[model samples]
Target: MPIAPKHLKFDDGSVTIIGVDCATQSSKVGLALGSMSKGLLTIDKAMKVGKSGSIANVVSSWIRENSTTKTLIAMDSPLGWPIKLGEELIGHTAGSSLSTEAHQMFRRRTDFFIKEQANKQSLDVGADRIARTAHAALRLIDEIKEQVGMSIPLAWNSELRHPISVIEVYPAVTLKSCRLLSATSYKKESNGAREQIVDGLSEFMTLPEADKQSIIDDDDILDAVACVLAGSHFINNESVGPATTEDSALAEKEGWIWARMPR
Candidate 1:
């Protein structure tokens, strides 16, 4: 894998990355915090948000606690909808005929790009239950921004000097990039499958026994950890980005999913 050109350089050790497996309900969301130093990734904390907790509150608290470290938040949810869908819906009537293709209207350019690059398809944010999750994720980001008093923009590269930054990630695609996908379903109640995944992940980062056990016990926690891995790839410039000028324009509106490409 080639390292993409960096727009700005900074110490990897100074940055703190958080992976959030976002969901509509706080109880289903997973959060993890880690940092990379000397090419080794260390996970300091990982947990579910619990029924009474709030994602924004937890994240803002972390920002306040770690005031000096740059924070990169990688969330597992679509941050934007298709550009065509929004354009076509402006004057769309109940009985009007739509000109755009269904897939183009529902899916963003980044969605198709992920399918081609990672051989995985993300759910259509314009036409799926995932849309609700996306809405919740964006709302949570806004709340965090309000609380932290910073413009937490979606980062395009690793130059994160801001107090906070965000990126979209897909854990399934991250798993595929790492060749960790197995015939056995890890998302099910099978600890054996989850254990296999944690074992495979050891090749990329060192996981404490407790963190490994927590990840194996819950698929959400595993995904949150995977999101952290994706964040690592992004911060290191190992993840793929916009391929063309047009694609870059579309990504600003439709949002991009930063994941490590399969080797």
Candidate 2:
């Protein structure tokens, strides 16, 4: 079944938004925090994860500092494991019943949904390119949940109306929707590819050229910008790809990746 995107409602320009590109290694995570005021969006904070830095500390500190502001965090990570996979991991599945069909049966609805909408697919948390990152992300999620409380998923935020919210993000999918670059390109070590991405992003938004060039070699920073934009998109009611009816149960386990935001 195809997953439909969720529409979120927010008070006019009142929330501080944050975006994080979660990485298994702390040094690679990227963060962008900002807000929209009078219809003009501005990013006031940007950081590339350093070897000595901790993702938990950065997030916690940001929340603490912004205590008075309503907040929305858009993170690039899998917050939960697939339900069937979770059962198998916890020994809840019959040994004889741990079949491929069973795994397929519980595949995350959002993954298929994103593929259909963005022509991009997310890695399965159980076993995929992002598996390790997903594990690391879930740990951060637990810590943040304790500090900030359970976050409202994008799909549910419209009705629930929480002061703080979090939604899964995919930069490649987001970039594709924005038409800045193809999902498969611009994520490479080569200078040519990096320059292409940097140039593409520059065209979409007003960025400090010098600062933008400094992070051009690192796609992580570009993704951080993408995540931050996704957060802004959510706050602006421009985000798409939320959990559908069939996805509620799976989204509770495997988090939904909000796709289809224009720049």
Candidate 3:
């Protein structure tokens, strides 16, 4: 609930975008790196985190290798624990007396805002709904910190405006915003749902017809691609959601989710 920051611009041809969807199952974690050149996005690297060894090591290495080049990472995980949840998890004195209503009201401002904009509900990071993902994400953050020496969890993407930046992204909202698929329908493995989602994303992103099959088969990959697309907008200064003042305390403590951009 803070005033948004000024748009941060990047040199069009120099930015490399990374997208990641973190999951408890290493195999389900998606990773992709790409760049826009001449109006076309070329996915230069794509893989499942499990296959690449430590997700932290792999991603941090890639980021460091590209540190000299403008880069923006769009991650599909809660980068920071919600303010209320953090207290609850650690048994802070302030949250000891919080009631259910108080807990509900204390959800991250960005989470509610993004849900409203995307017309879909996101699991509250403070609740059990996303405990596993949050845990995994926190581990990944730790790994990045140890390996890349970056404080991704607490870094301010807007103010940094550095060669390497990070933002949280939600794939379902991204897909829905692109009008490619309903967020719920395509994520499952049943009834060719996965294939449908893949095909739709391939078509929508204008990926090469011959190359579509390879990247589209995995839901993780699709989400990663969507994350990269979101990062693309981010570098272009077209992203949504950033709290600078209104709930400054909570905003800084619970990093915001930067969702879909206008077409």
Lowest-lDDT window of 10 residues in candidate 3?
Answer: 1-10
Clashing residue pairs in candidate 1 are none
lDDT for each residue of candidate 1 in 1-263, tens digit (9 for 90 to 100): 11112323454467778899989999999888887776678787888879998888888887666655678999999999999998999989999999999999999999999999888889999986899999999999999888877778999889875657999999998888889977777899978988999899989887777677889999999999999999999988989999899999999999999999887
Best by lDDT: 1
Q: Name the candidate that leads on TM-score.
A: 1
Comparison by TM-score, 1 against 2, better one: 1
How many times do residue backbones clash in model 3? 3
Candidate 2 lDDT over residue span 104-163, tens digit each: 544577777776676666776667567889788777767776665545444445322665
Q: Rank order by TM-score, top first?
A: 1, 2, 3
Candidate 3 lDDT for residue 19: 84
lDDT of each prediction vs. the true structure? Answer: 0.87, 0.67, 0.67
Per-model TM-score on C-alpha atoms: 0.92, 0.79, 0.77
lDDT of 2: 0.67
